[model samples]
Target chain A: MAGSNPGCGTTRTFKYQVRDQFGQVMLVYNMQLWDSIVTTSTNTCNLGGYNTTCAITNTGPCNVGTFADGTFNENLGICAPAGHLVSGGCITGCTTTADQTWNINGISLSGDVKNLSYQCDRSW
Target chain B: MYTLLLATLLLQPIWALPPPPSEQGLQVKLRANLENYTVAAETFPQALTKVAAQFEIPMGIEWIRTSATQREIRRSWRHTTVYGVVESLVKSQSGYDFAIANGVIHVFPKGALMDRSSFLNHRINKFEAKNEFAGVLSYRLRELLKRTISPPLPSSPALGTAGSIATGAGDRRITFRLVNASVRQILDKLSLATDFRIWIVTYPEDRTLTETGFRRVASLYTSSSVADNEQPVWAFLRWGDALPK
Candidate 1:
């Protein structure tokens, strides 16, 4: 690829070869393309137990994927994997406390703000 | 004597306007129907004024006196276009050029509109930017995104089997060595690199369900390669959206 991400940012295409028992190639896929919109942003949250009392107000349709696979848990207060990830980067809709800490996409909100460090232990 | 001649010449009006248009170049846009014009037994200027008054349109066409424009041309057609009258009169009166802009007509001598300065006098032109060629890249990327990301085809030497039953079929995955990999190969690599699903919906006409391999989708949207990357999809949506009119 020319760039780290080459080609138009449309759907990436895949090719497969179909063959009879003798293993000669067959048909090909006609790869057409289309459009999409996905923008993201980030913010700080007071992890006073970010999972519990810490109020991190981000817009909905967001996710905080802070796991090994970068997967996210929905309710930060729950502190458990809800199988969601940060597509939009703000703790998507996990506004447990109301404080107007920041604004995004022209929508203002109030929330507790703080930074926390994370450590991971090797499982395998 | 030279000073007197200079003063006399300086006193004359520069005659900023060109000599009155002789009948040659004429282009006119017919705004209203020809029947709407009331032909009169008068000078060309008077006839033009009558038509302008009847139509209630402000005098958009310039009124310049010339043998061609001033000639007492009579109405020939009972019903026709506004331009039809102008064209007819121009045909009747040789050596005149007629041009119309936004319902305003200016009949001048041939070659009158041809001013050497300004782009309007230059040839019409068209242009496209180098980046617009990104459309080609978009097309190529789309070509790559339509296949099973896995190497699905490789043949292993098989041993003759007993008549009872068959087992362990399709176990070998083919590793392809593409010399000049196509968009398909590039997309195949992308699918391997990412967790995105590249696919096309199949219709029964593509072949019976028993057929192996993807059938091109009938609908253009359903048939082409598409990706899950939301950002690129959005960019593709807005492609060529900002083209100048």
Candidate 2:
């Protein structure tokens, strides 16, 4: 969503989160200005039995609770309007064009696997 | 001596004592406390209505009707008789008058109402117009003068034709192009184009006056300055006040 202008010589930030079924904190996605250049948020998840299940917390200031039923897709990094599909942020394919790079450590046989970080792109 | 005193007392009449004021004679009484009422600038009629309402006179209806109902009147009152305030309001306007009928004061046009004999005795004020078909503007001018213009009872709208005057004294086309014109100006324009004379009106057996020429004749008028901020200036045609010949 295109948030309103904070006015001349000001800034604004939108905060997001991922929690479990019982509102347990699992991830924090904060989109903010990079010193005055770009706006992006980075987070990781596990999918395909990758030892991760995350849910989006669209609460006010960012309250989209109407579609925050906990279901999310791994590849698209999106959620269904009414179901609870849990997946991780890590992908098997490697791409050099990634903007963010991080490490994902899970309970599977995966070691400290280096992976490209991602953020949900919502532009209005 | 006791018998004589009793006869004297009984002979005195109760009517000798003067009666108190009746309800009609009593001054206006406010239903609310408005001694400190100071409002923003408003028209004369609006102010009069506000002041009258202090004495519980109803507002928000066409209580006042006249051609010269002043739009702006600035005055105040404190502990004055209601009719006195009303008289002051009447003085604030021109070509306007008021009357008390059945104990309720009404502000109306100068010649708004008249009896059958009086109606025929009075003459419609002299009016002059130079632009447009004075005939059409006459009715529109009358509409502007009324507090509540009584439009002809609704009927299916239709256009009846009248031929040229030279051909057989037929109908003529009157034009109107006024911009913020006053009631007097409108009446003037109507007088010039139409024969300033208002004919006694008549209706055909067909229930429409489209054809004209049955019997009765009367004139009406109204005026006010209550148009809101965007008092429109009509300018469809170049029909302006005709210059002197």
Candidate 3:
């Protein structure tokens, strides 16, 4: 995975994997970023869609009856149960959504692209 | 005197162009037989289909066979072919046929008053790129026609595929028949020579039929062949994903 950074106007591969306490690897996600630097000029990178290759691991002893599932928002950010949080920020953005749009493999991300206030809801 | 010699050199007869190879005479001899080709004994229908479509001409496949052997002994096949062209009433026509024996293809052309001949030659090569391998073949079969025949008239109809038949055993063995026009078209389009074949082996279970998996296998074929000093004589394409640990 240690390769040259994708060119400014080109695409690059961005991947993520989820692991449980016992180091058992779970789900893995992969994406292709059309451009690494996402600013007003270059604002989009394809977020890899869901992966069926890896399973979700819920192997924690402190788990309640309900499973603690984690979800990733390519546009908004990463979300976990109230008590649990994705430490490293698996999801990037929420910094600025003004004139910026996000897509994964050519599909636009579902949800609100703007906030009721004039301010852009650019955090995730 | 030097100027005179130079002028003489420039005056050399253009008609002195060497005659076609002896093997390519008026009647191109498509070796009496043909041969079948394979990669480690397995036939890759997808690659065959794709390449066949790419290399062959429009209708040139009429001269080949879909399946030449019976079920029992399947090793023998024909890989090369030959053709000849003749003139008829104000119009020009060509006859084409093939003979297979021992993994080679020999094409022969036939027709009324057919008085022309030509030869074609082919060769295959492989290369490496990024995480994959690539394969290509150099072809010159037209010479084969010219050498076997004396004078060749204009070629007739282009070549393409007749059809294909596929049968596989579980997940291990697969067989395919790419005959006639289809075969000729692929070789022609790719300019594939006879020196080697290209194989694209897949990973069996890859659900994604996209070009990524197929292209990777093709690249591997070239890279491996180059390292072994052997050109990509054949290709094997498969698709599969790794099992969970």
The most accurate candidate by lDDT is 2
The residue-by-residue lDDT of candidate 1 on A39-92, one tens digit each, is 122211221222110111121211111112111111111121222112222222
lDDT of 3: 0.20
Off by over 4 Å in 1: A1-124, B1-38, B58-68, B116-245
Q: For model 1, how does the per-residue alpha-carbon lDDT over B1-245 read when each residue is reduced to its tens digit?
A: 00000011112111122122112221222435665454764455455445433433222222223444546657757678766766665555566556643223444345534533211122212211121112223222332322122111346221110000000111111122334443323323222221111211112122211122222222211222322211011011111111111
Docking class of 1: incorrect
TM-score, model 1, chain B versus true chain B: 0.30
Sorted on TM-score, highest at the top, how do the candidates line up? 2, 1, 3
Model 2 chain A: worst 10 consecutive residues (lDDT sum): A55-64
Per-residue lDDT tens digits of candidate 3, residues B174-211? 11122332223334322222112221222221112222
Scored by TM-score, the top model is 2
Q: Write the per-residue lDDT of candidate 2 for residues B1-245, one digit (tens) a residue.
A: 00000011112111121222223542334223344434223455455545544453321111223334435566676755566666667666664476543223445435533422211122333333333233223323432332122222346232111100000011123454656553433433332333221111111112211112111222111122212111111110011211111
Which runs of model 2 end up more than 4 angstroms from their true locations? A1-124, B1-41, B58-70, B115-245
Question: Which model, 1 or 3, shows the larger TM-score?
Answer: 1
Docking class of 3: incorrect
TM-score of 1: 0.21
